[model samples]
Target: MEARLKFAVALGAALVLPAAVQGADYFVTRQGNDANRGADWATSFLTVQRGVDALKPGDTLTIGPGEYPENVKLHGFGVPGKETLIRAELAGTVVLRGDRDVDLDFAQVPGRRFVYIADCKMDVLSVHEVDTLTNLAPAADPGALEFGPARYWHDAEAGKLYLSTSDFQPATCHRYTIGVLRDHGVDMLQCRRVVLDGLAAAGYRTAVGKEGLLLPTSGFMLHQTEQCTVRRCTAFFNGSGITINSGVGGRTDQPGEGKGNLVEDCRAFANRLDGIVAYNPSGETIRNCQSFLNQTYGARFYGGRAGDAVCLMSDVLAWGNPGADFWTKGGGLSEYNEAVLAERCIALRDCNFGNFQHGIIGGRNVYRGDRPHTIILPGEHEEFHQFNDAHFADPMNFDFRLQATSSFRQSGEGEAASGPHPYKADIYHVKPGGNDDLDGLSLAAAWKTPSRAVARLKPGDTLYIAPGRYAGDLALTASNICIRGRGIEPVVIEGGLRLAECRDVSVERLQFSGPARAIRGGNIELANCVLFGQSVEAEQVEGLRLNHNLLVASLRLVGCSGVILNGNLHAAAPAVQTDTRQAVRYSSYN
Candidate 1:
């Protein structure tokens, strides 16, 4: 007798997309009004939500350069050829900020750098800078308030967000804003053949919803969506950067299944948790992406039923991250596990290839740094190769480009190159008796101002500041650059220094004085510097190090993890304060 044969029937009717004609193109601009027709740039829509709502099958929505503080939801669907598209007019110019503007009154605390408010209506994520959109970290306790600029805390029971404004008054500053908790930037739900390109999202946070669960926000979320593409996008400073999930873990129904998603050429960094996550995904493809300096995993693909199709994760760069760089975990029934093809990836730190009984076919991947590389279960990571001394062109400053002298530059047999990207790294110089018109290459022909030197730097570049006194405030916008002082004459800056929305930057042997904010930023390193007569506030920074520096000011850290303080000389007895749940590793602090 023949064995009984059973077939798994797919629930619900199959979604068949009908071919459509070319649709109209709508525009959204910052200068336009929401009540306009939104047909062209002249009469564009004001808000992103308006443009998103006007989208249909085969429709395209183009947004201009500006910040759109709206929680945009894209439920519009399209066919195979004429897909629904939402893109920026200029790549990397449009920003979707998940925050709201606010004006509040506060009273200054006695002998402290903080301000306080007793009663408030809503629980805010943090006090944000209106002009720069910089987020302040929430204070752990009001009683143990750290002396830092823009430190905040939200008392949920009393509905108060603690904000400290030492340089100005909170009520009259007119430069502060706040955001409600867990507001997602862009959510794609029940959509098909949708494409998101050249867009940026930030400022989403975690909050407790009314359902008594901790709800975390994503910069870009795709829920139960199929055939969607996200390319050339950037997500930073959110709860999670980009997430693709089926919502129901192993559901085989149409509404609970997600497949054929593509995420490529995207950058996700400085997020609170994982950079890019795909849960319960089927046939997902994520490639040519950079995920770095995040608090947790750089890329995580997990939670799929047994015997699912092979998912491809390739050409990914994961570096400067504290947690695991690339991780994969299997679902239930581990014997018949999800299959992942991970290749041509670069991990600067940790990489957990697979867990349970998942089959991970990995090859031509480069793993540098001293962190541990882990794999669970038999045959978890079969072809993974570790090069403890991989030669790259300035990997410290986020340049994963292979040099001409590197052995792994050329592929072996059928495999690709080892690293994730291909780019050049350059070095610049800044001196006292130099002109800004110079190319800033050699010290003999260097730039003059610190602002101009930093402006010319890209990721993975190093700027050498000569021994001199500069007078302008520095606001850094680029990430993964190093600024080092030259000579012994003391490279002094008589203004404030701010590094926001960036990661993996290092400053060495510089003197900062006479500024309220001496050194401030996320995921930065300060070593052998003089921070005098000011405050140093670090927010959302992981793997922060303050080493062998003369600190003559108040130091406050918020939301920082893996802190290292070694051989630092302090002017005061209790100058350092932190408001984090993580432990601080310190040695020889005077």
Candidate 2:
């Protein structure tokens, strides 16, 4: 583990006892067998459970880079001075998945538009797109599934999974993943002084209990754990993210065993419930974390909000959670009133509450949402994201990193400081006849295809396409990457680009000659481009900006908002056709 992951924010005075000598190190890998004792790399264990089961105080269980599909339970307690560590060999390389992969052989469902695979017994959470790990939309009826972007429906009674595909030959054209595990990824019960560093958990959905109540099945669930730390971890597509709960206990004002827990530098998104939740916690701290797009509240505290039970949250970024960005439940007691103390937080697109709960204090928060809720306090400040200004790099695609041009990049003493800082991204080049195997960092060693360059791009990176015609039919899932063409020689794409669920991407000085459904469910900008597609279509898009472009194709936008069309030449009759209410204008008609 890194030193930063071991560092803790102490809430009270603490004494460091004499350190116990370091214990043995155990290794786990996908290529090993469980019969091996996990003594070293050569004698590694196959299952993470076997490695964890063989741990002692001060022992480190180092997991190799691979997917470990198992439910891990930590029931042991570590001494005050000697803590147990469960860490990845490399940060963000190990995935603790709650789902198993299944090979589905699909066949056309007679006259229906969807395809079906039989003998699937498990109730799947979703059918995930292979590349991006994004869940396909769930269809209400299997018959309604279309031959387009993926969608799925499960007929549990018949034990079949139905899917919609891009082509008739579903198996050959598309790849997908179905999640079968419906339980907690990592459950910590009565664990003391343990550390979870640089791990990721995904694809867990809670089971239903009696009376149809959902059971607790978080990606990382800590119950009655004390002084434990979870840092540099990610949780997604689960029942809930990292949850710190008292389990079966009531709220208490006295110092309890469920205290001194820390969750920091973690990300939680796309869960069924709260991103990071605490129930009846005492002196818990959640900081420098991000939680977004969960079904419910982003970060929620339900009980134990008085006396020594005050939880602290700082430097957290939350957005797109339908419930609230940050929420705290007040027990209505006069003395036990304060539930949380939050500072230096950022919340956006939270249609419910925006960092405001009845018993919250210590706020230096920046927030913007359809509905904002907050309270003012001294030494604590608040800011809001204006619709007219750019606040984040791309919140639509869940990239909430602070842009270099954002005013919040440099903060004064009294302002709220949150979100990750943007760094200078390397520029990559692409040209026809270049080799995709070479590093696309320079023009001399440029990549061959736009698809190849797009795959290697980071959030802020730029891809420069040299003058030449290239094949398109590209599906862009990456956000915040700029793609530009050298306009001196008229670079062209034969098929056109497809933006799929991406955000804040910009294209400049490019030409598209083939039919295209150009935009889908994102914010994209096109400048100085020529589009000759039969019809350029955009659907359910958040923002679309077209500037100084020649569009030979008619524009069809449906269910879009925040669209701007300025100084664009349109050659087709009825140049723009759409259901969006945004005003559309063109500079010239040919």
Candidate 3:
């Protein structure tokens, strides 16, 4: 037994030693000799395509800085975990360009003749134009070329470019500079564990029948793959930044099951449609992704038949989009499977709409479907748990400042458990005094108060109020400010008070009633208070600690804990008043 244990340990060490020693072997160089063997850095392949062809499983291809005029595809059937990565060696540019000035049918430009490259792990590849020299004409300037009616005459016999309108004329032609044009640029299909990092894909023209560049026509059109990541990459001047749909060519699959894909720290700008469209991708996460100056929606998801299942997005900033910042439209059967979880997502400076829009918005149980299909805010519901407040900046043409009195302030609920997934990194850290807590007024109206009230508190500072009708929305901030009313006639903290990012604050003997919703805060404590709105179902609060308080409307607590009710609090429906014992029943306290 001792001898066998020693041998096993030795074998384990031997296997691990080779993995540590082999540090990035495969390399693609634009200046190195292509004839040399592509095994070592001294003898590397000249083009990215050559290195991709020579790569084996578990090989890391490092592309050196230079311009390479070609589209490369990697199509090797390898096992999972033995994937390939093509990364840039440094912070310089590596261009992947297409062939220019190729004689082809000009009339077929509207048709689908595309320059295509697909199925590879592309990383840090920068593409641009290649400079070429051409002949000169005398009539046109010294180094110029002309192709219009004054320089050349057309021939009716052949439907092509000829010198003359008669039989033919001697044409003085000179070569001119044209940008490297690639059509239907790069496509990845059935490729798992691929990383597209630090690469610029540009100058892709429209093909004869195809509408745009990078046309991924169905059949795992960037789908059905697992554990793939597209990070720090830029997709600009394209029809769609990345159209991830399984049903583009009329092929249907399970809805919202695009699993284990991460698009993080990437930028998509100037696209005609959505920056990133994840159609029917389940368990996919997009974090720290920014989209700016896009024509339409920044990010849109159409979770197909199976419904969008467990899609999470965090720290997503969408600015200057003409449409909604984020849109999730469910497609097929409504089994409550379209679950979209967003955290710390901001839609600032969007030209059209802001953060979110749905047929059913606010609180998961707000919708009366058989299976409870509602938006989950940052609190606890009976069936679902909302962990964060999906915040939105000021809308277009709105002059709301992001001060203590803005809606975006105090918009988030208190922090909850990060969950069991490995990708639950906090994208937006709520600032100290940014209306995160529910102890005071709404953040949107904080600045409208007297400057004296705003300056008296700081982060985490607590303030108590006497029973009086305090007009206007009182904005209470500072990290730990505890505000409480003295008298029990329900110290009416009237007006539109908004609370933001202030935590660990308690409010007592307060009666909030006015044109605005009551207090919105994180980690809030409410004791002996009456939240009397015009109607019993119009208040929007993330988390509330209501004790001996009368809630006249429906209350929602998202992803919160330690809520205890000790006094008479009734759900204000006229039908339930007949029974005195039922007037004060035990509500669920998570």
Candidate 4:
């Protein structure tokens, strides 16, 4: 077996140590010198690469603010019980830059129109070139570039670099922003149980000479690695943002190594290829994350290159990618194309097509301003046609919360768009005028109350309400049950609703007005609803989604975990408060 893949599989077994193993903590500061002892800030390392090179199995690397020009390749493995934490002393203040521009007077290429310069910084790869331009004439556009300039070429055979700026001034670059860097901000090889937190990685490179093309480079890359977590970090202006990658697949001698990682609370913007990409289908999770204005595409849950995975994405907001915000194509496995779950995600205005595309999606997911269909189904991608009628709160500035009066409010699903297999979900109608004696199956034979009619639900059951003044409150007891309002009118529940023991509950398109509050649910979704003159107190919410709702009063979560509050219109007064000390796992208050 290749050492990379074999090291990954060994992680599954439990090891009983003969002795209690303890780890050390190291500090890195901008003011400290690398030649020092590197034990504390007083004698800390100068660069992060020095600290990383000194890492042990259970070491903690606390890096302070400074510019790190070198790429950090994390070598050894760390066990889950003994994790290696490479975090900034403060979030978003530390920068690990891949490229450094020199004071250059582009040497006039002896009789040629362009000037040539070679300082050998591009020697990191076989064929050397700049990926993009910075501060040159017309700014860099998406999907096109120099290896690293406005106009540059590499003569690897002649051992020289050349460029043309028209103006003789030197330009800057964050070349290979998505793919190959001179190296990566953080590169993981055959690693496990590592944690990357609270840092900004930019000016990454993705051009590899042997490939003879501008390749992809991830600000943070995991190759033949598993069970790692990247939290509260930012990746921008790189070849690609964060990636949980599949290394060269298994050959006759070795197995492939990348799977089961988690990336959350991270923002990837203006990246060259994708903001965050998961090419390996290893049950990876991307939560509470946002990707916007990337040069090409935003975040890709599963590109389906060599295989497909059952990845989970919730409370994610992706927009303005020019390319689609999120992509999940039918990959290697036959069932892989359809084995993904998305919920309560706000995906909108991702180029000319649908905002989100997946094989199977759940209800209460607010998909607005996305087309041909909000949620593009599997097996119908080649026939994609952009459609109209989708709306947003403020797409020009990247806000996708539904306006209170949007016609598509709470209309996650009604009539499926044109596709090979349109969603055919069961719908149960509840109207105020209908009799309680009926079966509550249609609008004519609807139920008068919300509780009794919604009781008859299974996993995929949907309880749809018509516009009427209904009396009394409702409770959600089942898992994966959806309740939506009819598109034409508003459903008013005078008594409001309660969520005490519900699991995987979704409520959408209903107007609640009163002094009552909705609280205490597990894995609940509240989308496209308006709460006027009322307060909402949610508790024990493991995975909560509160999107596009108009709140006159505050919405509080007591013991919430992984709450996603996207595009909701809050009150001018104090409208939201939460004691969620845990990481904000999804798209935060918009």
On TM-score, the stronger of 3 and 4 is 4
The TM-score of candidate 3 is 0.46
For model 1, where is the 10-residue window of minimal lDDT?
369-378
The per-prediction tally of clashing pairs is 1, 0, 69, 27
How would you encode candidate 3's per-residue C-alpha lDDT over 226-306 as one tens digit per residue? 566666666654445655543333244443223577777777665546676666655677787877666576765554534
lDDT score, residue 296, model 1?
A: 76
Q: Highest lDDT among the candidates is held by which one?
A: 2
Q: Candidate 2's residue-wise lDDT over 1-590, tens digit each?
A: 46544554231213332233658899998899999989899999998889888999889999887788888877746767778899987666678887667767678778764565545788787666554434567788876676544677888998888777634455445666677766688878778889999999987765534211212578898877888999999998777889887534434333246668899999998777879987776678899898987777798666654345557777777876767777766442112233445655665543222333322222333332211123232331233323211443333333344434444443555544433332233566688979999876555566899876888889988777878989866567878988888435788998777888888899888888876564565668988889888878888777787888888878888877767676689899788888744634222222
Write model 4 residue lDDT over 1-590, tens digit each, in one string: 59978877666443534234556778898787889878988999988888988888878899986567778888657775777888988666577876553444345555544344554434422121233322122223211223233445554466455554424344232232112246567888878888999988876745433321112676787776778889999987677888776544322122256667888999998676778876645677888898877776676754343335557666677766766776654343213233465544545543221233422121222323332334432223333211111232223333333333333344455653331123332546677687778765555566677878877777877777767777767665677788877654677877666776678888888887764344555778889888774667776767787888888787776878877677789884565677855723544335
Where model 4 places Cα greater than 4 Å from the true spot, the runs are 1-22, 102-149, 154-181, 206-215, 247-255, 301-309, 320-323, 330-338, 346-392, 411-590
Tell me the lDDT of model 4 at 183.
Answer: 59
Compute the lDDT for candidate 4.
0.62
Local distance difference test, each candidate: 0.68, 0.69, 0.45, 0.62
| Structural similarity to truth (TM-score) of each candidate | 0.56, 0.56, 0.46, 0.51
- Alpha-carbon error at 523 in model 2, in Å? 32
Q: Per-residue lDDT tens digits of candidate 1, residues 361-429?
A: 122223222212221112233322222213433333444444444554445455444344432337666
TM-score comparison, 2 vs 3, better candidate: 2
lDDT of 3 at 509: 57
